[model samples]
Target: MAVGAAQYVRAMHTVAVLALDHVIPFDLSVPIETFGRTRLPDGRDAYRVVVCAPSPGEEVATGAFTLRAPYGLDALRTADTVVVPGTATPLAPLPAPVLEALREVAARGTRIASICTGAFPLAATGLLDGLRATTHWAAAALLAETYPAVEVDPDVLHVDNGQLLTSAGAAAGLDLCLHLVRRDYGSAVAADAARLSVMPLEREGGQAQFIVAPWPATPRGAELEPLLAWLEAHLDEEVTVERMARQAGTSTRTLIRHFKEQTGTTPLRWLHRARVRRGQHLLETTGYSVERIAGQVGFGSAGAFRERFKRTTGVSPQGYRRAFGGAGAA
Candidate 1:
């Protein structure tokens, strides 16, 4: 006699979150909130999120609280996508069973992602070798040192390698999750999700913003800080090297040398980047015409502004505006 078997077919996409010991609450919740809140154009839920632990009914330790995951490793086997958040102890070895499950799922074509130092565990799976990846800026060097085979880039918010993806710390996870929505659906759908989260559809700057913004803690950089502030305040005016030197009370030659020593670039190059960053903000937040924005940002003409903007961002002004402009903007 044959026993009757029951099977249920699932239509909604499944996202499994693997919560290891000492998981970051924010990182773990990002996928659940982002994917869980998404709706199809017709208003149906887009994804079903399942939080799982290494073993069934296991209590995972978060700094603030202990969470007993309802599902076990079995949930990952059938998930369409799997997300791994960073553990409190990133250097600790992953359990053999967990490693085996991740390898098995990845080999079966399941998409996998990690947030922050989660790259550590993902790298251990041998999935990110020879592929570009990123983690929190503070941990980037360590991640690279720990996994030399993985090309580590600490300058971007996230890196997508088709099947494998990694994101930097904290809020960058939100950026990565929204990106997945864009990849699976389209920019419009992702934009809707972004709006729901009160986030920009697409942020303008990359990790360079974080890298370059902090003033160097040196006398050389400190001396130039006032001049940099003045430049920012007067971006709409013509800012020649000679003018900057005058503002800093130095000769042109000395000023150029100091800028290179402090900022790793010439004053003019830095000024151009600042202008472009400002232009990006305008395009994303304002309804001003490109020509007007060009003037506002100190470009001599719309043609000049267009050229500089494209050279800096790899996209035209109008294109960037359309892709990331305010919801009410045209």
Candidate 2:
């Protein structure tokens, strides 16, 4: 028992957060709060979190306040994981010493993660080259433009490239942290961490869910307004191209062309998205069983619903309910 307890104590991971000048306050706080607060199933703290700066005694400037990090870059040398939070000036060049330190640790096979615009610094180190990454949607273009070799995906909440992970803007950092917890431990422990943060264990949908749908900026949108409303209203019904064409007073081919031009997506794809979105709402607000929710969302079977829900939301329907179900949820 004593030996087992010693092994358990030794299993705690160390997470070093690199605090750069002009770092976003919220980004800096996310890892500190998330990793710092995690507890293992045995009720022991799972991670030892250290916030470090380029220099040990120096104060880093945040837009709102100055923070004195207790550790320095050397802390990264012994850490099992390293995290870089977003900087206010993401486009600004990283300090050479900081960059070198990151490269050294990464070469040693330490797991590293970047939150939001932190991808910029990680990309600048040339580590993200030949890897798919994501930053805040607002900065995705810039990250791609600056590091042409890096594939920047802007429509996902987070991207996990094994040792190197990147997350999209703001609260997505929380998502990435929880994902790491799940990867390191398992779902039950991660779910506990989520509760402490008052967040769902996992959120439904991608960054695409947060993006506003682009409607055609023309009189054509007015013509489709009623059709769109009808589609939304009848989400649980079979919506065939032929039925849509009849309602639009046009041939099927013309309706297909009109939908593509107006929504930049096929009619069926749009409907599927709508159904998944409705499923999400039901999961969040109602205590419906997955079978009932599946049928209500137009899926023919619970098995099909589970697969689609996992594909679209990166989580199963039951998992989604556990995270977001509002009242009387087990």
Candidate 3:
């Protein structure tokens, strides 16, 4: 194994967070809180996290507040992993020094990532050529327009293509970091960290969930609020357009038309996905066994659950659990 990999396995991984000037305070805190708080099976610190910047040991305004980071470029040199968080200055050209440091680290096979719009600095190194990545959803179009060489997918929460990874904005960074912990150490360790942070054990739902949230059920008010609440409550039941229309006091045609206009999807597809999402949450957070989980999620059998789970995520419930449930594979 490489030195960094060895160190990581031994629970001595060093994560260097590069904080540029005009940092977004929320982005800076995600890694600091998530990675710094992880622990090994014996409760020993699992990582050595240092907040470094272009000008180490200097004070910089973080949009919300000023921060004093102790490590500098040197920390980047020795890091087992380096993370660059998003900044308010999304298109600001990265300094040559920052580009050089990231390039060197990539060359050495040091693990690296960027959160939110932080992909700008990492992309400056040109290592992301031909790789699929994402930034904040709102920036996806610009990122693709600016860096035509990069494949930008705006829907997923994050893409972990081995040494290089990128995440969507804000809270999605938590999902990506927890994913890394699960990948490196095991699910058990990641679950502990999630519990500590008070986040979901695994959020398999993609960023599409967010991008698709606002417009869905828009023009929402008393007439539709009760219906939506009903949909969420009865995902496990075999709900049809006819039933939904009657409940909403509309005919089937009117109900379908309004739902499609608001949600950009047919009622059945939406209903199916709601069940899948509910199943995803249950799979990640519970140990009810596959049969019971399938029944609870409205699947008639374990086979049916496995089929839908595979179709949606390209993985089985057991596989998803192994990846996100903090346990070895079933």
Candidate 4:
């Protein structure tokens, strides 16, 4: 009999994290924390994480402080995967030796991923040419301008192009690392790692949500806050733009304008996202039928709920539940 992916084991996978000078501490720590903590069902460590710099024991500044890596560039030669963390000076030219090493490893079929502005160094290696990639939304424009051959998508949390991948800023690194774990083992293992990190195994939407500005501190915006709270509390009820306007003491036209300005989307669209998020939580924690979940989350029918859920999350409710549902789920 063939072993299932989650049950199959070989020698421990080696993940080498490449930390360069002026590395961003948060980006440097994400993969280390995520991969270092993952465990197989048999209670074995899932991966061997090694932090490597261009020169081991050399102090690398992280804006806030400096530290030394135990391994050197040669470690990349033996790694199954290589993760490059962002640096403070992302646009700065990469050291020739570092760039050469990355190209060498990638040529050998070693998987490579970048966190936030780390895309700069990866792009500098020419590996991202003609590939879709993303970085911190704030730096997306620069990444595109500097590397016209690379497609920079500012809206996604990450882009996986088989052998190479790139993640958006900050916390999106966690998403990318979890995705890699899922790709290597299975969703059950990835879900366990997510629980350890106190994060959902798969977050809805993308980096575009973070690019939106927060509600301005104005009277109109302030009123919308209470209206939003009310909407959440009444998600199971029939909601309409007109009803929302009435709750906020505004005309429907004005309410639409305020939502566009403050939330970067129409009121109904926001409600739909909230409903899908609620549905996901319920599916993860309960044994309730999909029809029951749809009704509880305010969808008019199960069919409509399934359509919207898949559109928003790229998976069916049942599929998501199968992957992430806890012991309480049926």
State which candidate has the highest TM-score.
2
Per-model tally of clashing residue pairs: 0, 0, 1, 0
The residue-by-residue lDDT of candidate 2 on 164-205, one tens digit each, is: 999999999999999999999999999999999998888777
Candidate 1's residue-wise lDDT over 1-330, tens digit each?
322323122667799999999999999999988999998786767788999999767688999998988899999998999999988788999999999999999999999999998999999989999999999877876787788899887768899999999998888899999999999989988898999899887776555444323222232447788898898889899999999999999999999999977765699987987888788888888888999999999999999999998776657888887767775354
**lDDT per model vs. reference:** 0.85, 0.85, 0.80, 0.88
Question: Per-residue lDDT of 1-330 in model 3, one digit per residue for the tens?
Answer: 334656656658889999998888888889888889999787777778899988876797886788889988889999998998999987888888888999998999999989998987777789888999989877776677678799887778899989999999999889888988888789999999898889986875566544423323243334566777798888767777899998899998988887766555677767766676677677777877888877876778888877876665556777767767753234
Supply the global lDDT for candidate 4: 0.88
- Scanning candidate 4 in windows of ten residues, the lowest lDDT window is 212-221
The TM-score-based order of candidates, best leading, equals 2, 1, 4, 3
At residue 4, candidate 3 shows an lDDT of 65
Could you give candidate 4's per-residue lDDT for residues 68-95 as a string of tens digits? 9999999999999999999889989998
TM-score of 1: 0.65
Say which prediction, candidate 2 or candidate 4, comes out ahead on lDDT.
Answer: 4
Name the better of 3 and 4 by lDDT.
4
RMSD of each: 8.0, 7.3, 10.1, 9.9
